[model samples]
Target: MKNFKEKFKLKLAENNYKFTRQREIIVETILENENWHFNAEDLFAAVKEKDSEIGMATIYRTLELLEKLDLIHILDFNDDSRVYELYLKDHHHHHLICKGCGKLVEFSDQGIDYFEKELEDKYDFSIDEHKLRFYGYCGDCRDK
Candidate 1:
């Protein structure tokens, strides 16, 4: 995770931004929790546990900077909130959300390459990335 922190610091430097203490704490917290999908409020709460002085405004600004730098991806599950995750190229997956219970299951990119290739051939367009989400009831929710 040290390398990732260094990369974030370098990105900030490249964009003429200082890697402030608050930003460092925020980034370190994010890196520590690799599988977290959280919004600004969630992040602020976690960060507050580490440092009480950090505020919501700092969280929002740091999130904006991270998104601008393409270090994180925002998942808008259409629930009136934005969730964030690290942008790891090799760690590609999609979401399966249970509407009834609000549960999230992650599925791997097993068959998407073929579909992307087909789309590229049909439309003569190059595909860069995509986000797929499936929403329905999980087994427990469905049985209920």
Candidate 2:
């Protein structure tokens, strides 16, 4: 948390954005759960549980700012709702999305790295980062 706080402060300074209590709370809420993906309403709800003074608009603005700062990434799983995940250096992974219950499972495979290289060789386009989402029903939903 101390590391993230320093990085967060440095990032805000880099962008000429002020580091306020509200922003710290938002970032802390995200850092608390490293793996969970959050939409605007969900993040606002979580932050509100911690500090009710935060507003929905502030959450949205902060999320947008984070995205712009390359500190976070937005994901869309073919649903209208958007989700956010923090960008950790070299910790790339993919998602398995349940269409029925809207659950997400994260996974990583080494073969994907090779496949990206193949793509780069075949198409001559350098691959920066990639996101893959496989949509299906989860076990509980499938059993129902």
Candidate 3:
């Protein structure tokens, strides 16, 4: 796995974006929270825990920069709100979202590769990227 800070700096340089102290703090805060499926507000709260000077607008701006760099995935689950997750390059997975409790489970399926290949062969089209999200009641939510 690449060092998140180094990767962030490299990305910033590649895009001609300045690596500011606030951006550094934002990147570190997001990287430290591996399990967090966060929105900008969530990130702002976490950042405020360590540095009270940072503002929500700054957090949103930093998130937009990170998203443009493909360093994170921004998802809108048709709920009018967006969530973000770290983009771990090379470790691809899909989301199983619980409709009842709003929980997201990460999963991978071997059949997906076969299907993607078949689609490419049949349609003579190359698939660059795909997103799979299944929404249903999770076991815990179903039991509840």
Candidate 2: which stretches are off by over 4 Å? none
| Candidate 2 Cα lDDT to native | 0.87
lDDT at 131, model 1: 84
Q: Score residue 97 of candidate 2 by CA lDDT.
A: 90
1-144 per-residue lDDT for model 3 (tens digits): 248789989999998999998998888888777674788888898899989999988998899888899888898788867889988876788998888878888888989979999999999999999999999999998998
Model 1, position 99, has a per-residue lDDT of: 90
Per-residue accuracy of model 2 over 1-144 as CA lDDT, tens digit each: 577678878989988999999999999998887575878887888899999999998999999988898888889776789988887776788999998899888998999989999999999999876778899999999999
Considering only N, C-alpha and C atoms within 3 Å, which residue pairs clash in candidate 3?
none
All candidates in order of lDDT, best leading = 1, 2, 3
Off by over 4 Å in 3: none
Tell me the lDDT of model 2 at 79.
74
Error of 2 at 126 (Å): 1.6
What C-alpha lDDT, on a 0 to 100 scale, does residue 125 get in candidate 2? Answer: 97
Residue 121 in model 1: lDDT: 100
Model 1: runs farther than 4 Å from truth?
A: none
Identify the superior model by TM-score, candidate 1 or candidate 3: 3
Error of 3 at 45 (Å): 1.1
